[model samples]
Target: VLRDERCTNLSSLIFATIFFGNLAFRAYYSRKM
Candidate 1:
């Protein structure tokens, strides 16, 4: 159970980081344009 929780947490962190990174890249590209 603990392992499963850890897995979920890690996935959540990765997903959030990727999401934020995409948002930042989009904003940067829009500003450049």
Candidate 2:
């Protein structure tokens, strides 16, 4: 579907996924330590 287009939604989704993942990871590590 996004084969020929610059998909901002896709990038945004990826960024959000990574951002939340990092946030959760940090929280987990901080809680552990």
Candidate 3:
């Protein structure tokens, strides 16, 4: 349980980063179109 807390937070942060990054990339591509 001790390590799980840290892993969960890190995993969520990574997921959030990727999600936002993809949204941003899509916006950029849309603007170019």
Candidate 4:
């Protein structure tokens, strides 16, 4: 149970990082254009 919880948290963190990164990239790209 503890291991499963840790894995879930790690996956979520990674997902959030990627999501935010994508948003930032899009914003920067639009600004550049």
Worst lDDT 10-window in candidate 3: 2-11
Clashing pairs in 2: none
Candidate 2 lDDT tens digits, 10-33 = 788899999999999999999999
Q: Is candidate 1 or candidate 3 better by lDDT?
A: 1
CA lDDT for candidate 2: 0.88
Clash count for candidate 4 is 0
Q: What's the TM-score of each model vs. the native?
A: 0.90, 0.74, 0.85, 0.92
Query: Relative to the unseen true structure, what is the C-alpha lDDT of residue 4 in candidate 3, on a scale of 0 to 100?
Result: 100
The digit string of per-residue lDDT tens for model 1 on 1-33 reads 999999999999999999999999999999999
The models' CA-based lDDT, in order, is 1.00, 0.88, 0.99, 1.00
Model 4 over residues 1-33: C-alpha lDDT tens digits? 999999999999999999999999999999999
Model 3 stretches with alpha carbons more than 4 Å out: none
Error of 4 at 12 (Å): 0.4
